[model samples]
Every structure is written in C-alpha cells, then in structure tokens.
Target chain A: MSIDTSTAARVAKLARIKVEDDALPGLAEDFNRILGFIEELNEVDVEGVEPMVSVEPMRLKRRVDGVTDGNQQDKILSNAPDAREGFFAVPKVVE
Target chain B: MSDLTKLTIAEARDALRKGETTSAALTEACLAAIEGAGALNAFVHHTPEIARAQAQAADARIKAGDAPALCGIPLGIKDLFCTKGVPSQAASRILEGFKPEYESTVSSQLFERGAVMLGKLNMDEFAMGSSNETSVYGNAVNPWKRGNDEAELTPGGSSGGSAAAVAADLCLGATGTDTGGSIRQPAAFTGITGIKPTYGRCSRWGIVAFASSLDQAGPMTKDVRDAAIMLEAMCGHDPKDSTSADLPVPDFEAMLTGDIRGKTIGIPREYRMEGMPEEIETLWAEGRKMLEDAGAKIVDISLPHTKYALPTYYVIAPAEASSNLARYDGVRYGHRATLAQGDGITEMYEKTRAEGFGNEVKRRVMIGTYVLSAGFYDAYYNRARKVRTLIKRDFEEVFAQGVDAILTPATPSSAFPLGMEMDDPVQMYLNDVFTVTVNLAGLPGIAVPTGTDKHGLPMGLQLIGRPWEEGDLLNTAYALEQAAGFVSKPAKWW
Candidate 1:
C-alpha cells in the first residue's frame, strides 16, 4: 500500500517520535520503500517449513523461577532527572 | 612495558603472570592511547581513576596468586551496556543522562574475571545505525585509511566504537552486542574478529534491550583466539534473563583445534546474489579455497528462504523492539518534554517521546507499532514470524545433511561512505541482509576479515555454525584467518 503523509504522521505519533509537517512526505516515501522491500518475500514458497526458533534444535535452557533483583536501586536511580521518596518522580497526572 | 596498547588479552595476561608487566602499567597504557586518539570519537566516557584503582587491585590479586583469566586485562564496555556509577546512554538524547545502579550481566561477568574497564565505547543511538554516524555523540573514525583524506570513514555501528577501539589499540578487547550484524559487520569493516554466539548464550539482564529475542552480547578483538577467550568468559547461565539458557558453558578456547581436516563446509548457493560486488565474490571464493586446501570438504547448499530473511527480521525485530522500549517513557527513565500551550499531560507525553528519540529509532518504533497493531498483526508480524521459522528450518536441514558449518560473505559490500544512507533507508537495511538470518535462526556466527576490496576497504567472510557450536565455528574461522594471511593495520594513529 502507498503510505500517504497522513499515514506517515500516524506512524510517527504511534512511534512516539516528532517529525515536522513538511518531513512527512519523506517519511512516507521511506516507509513505502521498506514495504516494497518486504513485499519481495511473498514470492518465496515455504509450504511445509517450520519456523526456526534457533540455529540449534535444542530446547531453550530453563532457569529456576526466582525473585532476586541486583538490589542497586539507589545506584540505578542516581542518574534520574527527577526523583522523590526513593522512586523516579514524574509530573502529577491526577487532581 | 613493550607498548601495552598493542598487546592482546592473552599477551597481557602472560606478561602479568611472569611479573613483566603490572595491571597498573597496562591500564595506564590504554588511558594514554585513549588520550592520544581523542579525535577518533571512540569513547563516550572514561574513568582513569577507577581503571587505575582496578588495575592496582588486579596487581594485588596477582601477587597473592588469585588471578582469574581476565584479571588486569583492560577492555572497553560498549556504552549500550549498563555500568554502575557510569552513564549508560545508548547514544541517544532520550537516554542522555540515564545511568543504572547495576552492571549488565556480560559486563559484570567480565569484571568478575577481573577485566579492567577502560571506559564505555560510543555507538549509534539505541544501536540503530550501520555507521556510527547515528550516534548522538558523533561518529567513530575508521582506523584504516585510503589516502591523505582521513575524512573519517565509518567504524560501522552500533558497535562501531568497540570495533574501532580494538582495531586502533585503544583497548585490548571490547564488548559488542549483535542484534543484526551490529558486531560482525563492524568487526569486518574495521579488520577485527567478532562472534555472535547462539542467542541466549550470554545473559541480557542489564543490557538495554534492542530486539530482545535477537540481541546478544559478544566480544570484538584483534584475533580469533582473543575473541574465543572473551567469549568463554562471557557465556554462562543467568537466571535473571528468562531467555538465557541453563546449558553447560563449554571451554571454547580448549575446542580450538585449528584443524578442519575432513570437515564439510557448506557454501550456500543462494548467498552469491547478482548485485554482490566482484571483489567480495572473489574473497568468498578465496576463503572456500583456503578451507578446502586445509582438507575440509566444500559442498553447495541452498537456504531457499534467504531472500525473506531481511524482511522477516525487519518486521520481527521492530515488533519486539517497540514492546521492549515502551518502558523508556519520560515518566520512568528518559527525557521528558513539556506540553505546549493548550496541551496537557497526554500531550506532554507525546511531545517528550517525539523529541527524545532519533529518526531511525522512531522509524523502527513506528514500524513495530504498525505491524503489531490489531489490524495488521496477522498480516505483518505473524506472517513474518512464520517466514522466520522457515528460515531457521532451512539451516536445520542443511546442518542435518552432514554440513559442519556454512560459509558466506558477512556483508554484501564493503563499508559505504559515512552519509551514504541518510537519504536511502532501503540501502541502509540491505547492509544487514547477509547477517540477519543467523540471528533469526538463533545460530552462532563469526565474521573474519577475508581480504580488502579494490577500493582498499576491508571485506569479511561469515561462518555460520550449528546451534551452540561456536567452538567449531571459531575453529574454522581461526584456520581461514591463518590461511588468508590478511593482516590489516589502521592508518597512522592520529
């Protein structure tokens, strides 16, 4: 499908990235090219093929279910721009 | 100390063991090298005092006969990995000042083995670009040169700085994460050796998630053996990473037999597409000839689903990435923007995220969100996943037919000009076509320098091995590396 400027704008909003109104055309063009490239896959026939989870056929290794964090909360929060009461502080959302 | 900057981790360790060099001396050498190469833009941050203190501790440990394999070995941690007390922005304005209290599992593992941190290396914003040009911190220059024009060739990202630093002798070895040729391509571009072990080989606990299912941490180094040594240290079971395997870690170094006698190496017929440069084809042919001369059998195989790999990866990776990066909203961990006049909190959120992430990152996030959206989920994401399965199955069938490993070009072409992709997203994505499938199949692959192209730019040969068979993969790469006899040194140190 041809990606229009409006579609491009929606994509940008969905992606949570800001793009100027004038740049939407370029974004739309880029998206169309990517989609065009993706369309090339439709020609390949994968009838009985099973999707590969890994190069090796071994099952994923399982670990014991446990709840232990690295416990460096203060160190982790050290770089926060806004912190309050030992948590990341943010602008209030509710009245 | 015999110009410690040029020493490999193995050489440094031997020197330390024999009391010929101290960790302090090694660390100082690296720090001096970093200072000397300041214009290369290889580092995001440096901690000389911490490095010196760590080096002293390593010396004390050596004196007490308590040294681990990596004790005192100075290495660069990619800025993408979280390092306690150090800013760990994935080279984006979104994470401009973000730091983590805990070190990433791979980094911490290296530290436990006593590797001294030289500093965090630079990368593309959120590991998004092929060239380090996407980095908010500026691009890393290719250590190698063409003429007097040091117009700063790309070091290849998002692990560009890691590859450049190791190649430039700024660090003995460096950590790199490969999601889709990130590590291998850069390694190839910079004339270094890098391996992306089978997915889940290294825990991804604290590393910033890129494409969680495909993201894996590995080592970038001057030689295959050093890569092996670092890989050995980096692999282990970590309960914290749900996807991390609990399998026994093998002694990768011990398995480097250097003898590929009678091994069957598959040369995928599909990899040599029409547009591949003649020089790269020649190099691939030369690599196959070298392995055959070493008594290995060569057979032509087909990965029929090869063409679908790039598209499948583009869809799956972005789909997962969008979900994984959702946690980075301004309220929790990254930059926040203020609402404009007449806008409210929701608008504030919209503004913060839009302003925070870079263009490529935003593109991926949007692609991901679109594919995962209710209406398109089946048509895009699900279909891509099915194709991914087919790609994986193709490798499985080939390996099942007595092929010990597969050999192909790491990339279709050599490093393009720095700004070549700024106006062309398709061209940029094509750069990863050759390397993305291995990740999709969750197989181990390594990129070794094959030879230089006509333009004198370096090209690489990628070796794909069966799942968890990194040892065999490295062994073949080591043999080819020895036979190719392509020793490359970057242009004169700035």
Candidate 2:
C-alpha cells in the first residue's frame, strides 16, 4: 500500500516521466500520501458490485466502420515537432 | 457603453434584440475591461481581433433575424478547450505555443451560436490542481479580497480564472470543466454561478481530457439565469463523442420558473463534516430555510459513501490523466525536450515531461501510473470504480424517494488567501468535498452565491440534482438565488 523510492522510480519510468535518483524519495513520499488517502476505498464492501464504466446507462453507440473523414496528412502533421515527407519524424526508432 | 461587460448574458441578449446595443460595443467593452484587469491574470490570451470579427458576424446574424440564445455574448474559454488557432494551453507549460488545429466541440457549438470569445482563461495545469497556484501563468488572483484586506485570495481552481474573470466582469461567463469540483468550487469561491451538468449532457470531443468519466463541461456565469442560458447553448449531442448522450438538451433557460413549491429537497447528513466552518454550517441552515420558505419540502438524507468521493476521484482522475497525457510524447504536438548527443525517444519523453509538467501534475501522473500498474490495478483503480458506483447509487436512492434536489454548503469555507494550503495537497483536496460526489454520481450540480463569510468574502450553496436534470437543478438554484438575493460583487482589487 505504500510506495518506496524504488517503486516511485518504477512508476515514473512507466509513466515516462523522468524522476532523477535524488527526487525518487520525494516522489515516493508524494505517492505514499496519495495512496494513503486512496486506501479509504478499501473500507467499502464492493462484493458483487460491477465496476462502472459509464456514468449514464447507455450502450456505447456504434457507427458504420468507414472512413468518415481523412485525406489531410499535412493538417494532421501541422503541430508535429518534426514532420518530414508527409510523416511524423521521430528520433530513429529502428537503428 | 459604460459597462457592457457587466451585463449578464440574458441582459446582453435582450439589449441586443431591442437594438439598444450591438455585439461590437459589448465586445469592445469586454476587451477594454480585460485589458485593464491584467492584475487578475484571469485572461491569459486576449483575442480582440477574433472577438471583434465574431462580434461583427454576430451583429449580422442578429440583423438577419437569425440570432440564437447566445448571439452577441462575449465569453472567456478555459484553456482546457482546444480552441482552433488560439493558445489552448490548459494552463500548462507542456502545451506552450500549441494552437490546436481543430476546435473543441463545446466551444465550436458556442461560436456557431454567435458567442464571441474574448480569450482563453487560466486554470490548473491540465485541470489538475484545486488551487490556481499550479497554473503556468501564475495564480489567477481572486478579484475578491479578504474584507478590504490587501492580501490576494485564491479564486479556487481548475476553473479559477473563469471564476475570477466572471467575478471581475472581464467576461460575462466562461466555460469550466469539472472533474472534481473544478467548476463548482471555483464558482463558489468567486461568488459566481457554475453548473456541471450530467456526465454525458455535454460532449467531450475536443476538451483536453482530464479524468475522462469525471470531466463534464458547464458554464460559469454571473448568476443562475446566466448559467442556465449558457449551459443550454454549450450542450448538445455530438456524434464525435460516443459518450455524449443522444438525449435532447432541454431549454434550461425556459425551465427557470423559480417556483420550487412542493419540490422535495434533501439535506445530506454526510456533507456535515466534522471541523466544518461555522459559517458554512450556518450558510447551509440558511439555505435549507430559504428553500423551505420557497415551499420546498426539506428532508434529511444520507449518502454514506460521501467521504470516499475525494479518494475515489484522486485515484481515477490521475489514472485517466496518466493515460490521456501519454499522447504528448515527443513525436507529436506540444513541447518537445531538447535532447543531448546520445539521447533517444524515451529520453525525450522523460525530459520533456519532467521539464514540462508542474509539480502537482507530476505527482498526479505518478500516482495515476502507480495505481494502474500491474500489482495495484485491482487494489486501487478497480476498487475506486466500485466505490464510485456506490457513491452514484446514494444519489439514485435519494432521487427515487422523490428528492428533487440536494443542498449543501458549496465549500468548506470561503475563499482563503492565496498560498495558504499550497504545501499540503490533502488540505487542498478537501475543497472539493461537497462538490465531488456529484461528479462521482454523474449528476447535475450548481453553485449559487448565497451569502458571505464574516470576512465579507462570498460563500455559496450547492444544489445536486438528478442525472440529466440540469434544468431542474438550475431552477432550484434560481429559487435559492431569488431567496438569498446575493448581489455582492467582489470589490475590484485587480
């Protein structure tokens, strides 16, 4: 129920947020505090209760699986930090 | 001409239709006010050119006799909304300079109805914090001071800037999305009216996702009627958001009859927390009496899981946030970290996020990531969802018993001075205690300014209504507004 420095580091990595070595303890403490607060949920008797996926009682609406809109690769890449040749350019993933 | 910015949406609409005022004049007045109120930091982006053009278009629409309800009204948009070409940062550094290519569905709907946008307002970064202090633009100073004291008070958060803007008359109203009391808490803090409609009442198409299930968009306005008017224009079923209900958006403005005679109002016993401010308690009692005076049958009720709403919110919101924010990886839009010689994509995401997110955001993302992790998923995320169901059932039970609305103190206390609880996140989280249950249950809730604390700061009373019953909720609040007759505006310090 409590997160230690190593756990915090693991979580930060999983979240893709960089928490340096020195900051992990502090991050752990923050995590512990939040988790401690959230531990109150364990008191509830949730036997046979369905985890709510939607607030309203409605089945997810379905639409015909077709391309409703597209054909604007330029617009899609407009805000990219690096877009080249009509594609999003990232640091070389395949070396 | 003197104070067109101060006019409520209804008044502005009436004046415009009577040919007594033009949208251009209203826009100019609001723009001038916004320019002058720089001290409040309510408006982070000033769009006078866009406002003028929209106002001009609105004038043409009005002249053509095709004006909608929001025609010619100027309003401030929360930074969370992806306003096309406007800097919609959600008050975060990560999104610095990111002008969204597409408009958020709610905002586009408003614009389509001829609502003019003054600019983007400040908020907690990604709508994460209870105090506006977490905003990258610095805290939006509360226009209301502590009874003529010089120290600045917080306008409450996530929707703090929206509240402050409406309170200071910088804009007639502003859009606010409440994940956990972001709208109602700030609205209470700033003595304005805010309503978070039922979860699916408004589409979430272009809103920067916070807690997907919990985040519902609503209007923060000067009064109950204005809140009603703006909420109507802001809501519709959008096919783009599958969660959006196909149910019709009722004429919320027309439903404000202010006659709640024979309406059953519940006073939830669970909301009366220990250590609650005497002022808030008295305010709640006064609210009960006022509703009673309006012929509402007041009954005591119990929502047993009320105490757990905040805990559930913290878990679910951040868990969803961690996932939603994953899209901000370096490859796409938003701030990308400057890399060192040997760095790769992982390094880029880490550094970008580490530098980009504020401390509160980082903490939340960490918590969210932790809860959804392998070992803890069932213990945390799944458990919170079940508690959420219980919390929701509490409301359903009350409503099934013919309880039309539930009234409680909007906040634990009036707006506190800025920086009072910055060190303690738990203390700050308590601000949403009264408001979060509505979000957990996906019910319509509104905060109506009802009274003032001893320090003369405004205090509000909240009314929780049935699901998709914003019109009824607004009407109940309208009755409270009539009874309380709270007309005190914060003395303009900024």
Q: Top TM-score: which candidate number?
A: 2
Q: Candidate 2: list runs displaced more than 4 Å.
A: none
Candidate 1's displacement at residue B405, Å, is: 1.0
- lDDT for position B127 in model 2: 95
Spell out the clash pairs found in candidate 2. none
Local distance difference test, per candidate?
0.86, 0.91
True contacts kept of each: 0.50, 0.84
Model 2, residue B233: distance off in Å is: 0.7
TM-score (C-alpha, index-matched) for candidate 2: 0.99
DockQ of each: 0.51, 0.83
Candidate 1 ranges with C-alpha deviation above 4 Å: A46-77, A92-95
Interface RMSD of each: 2.6, 1.0
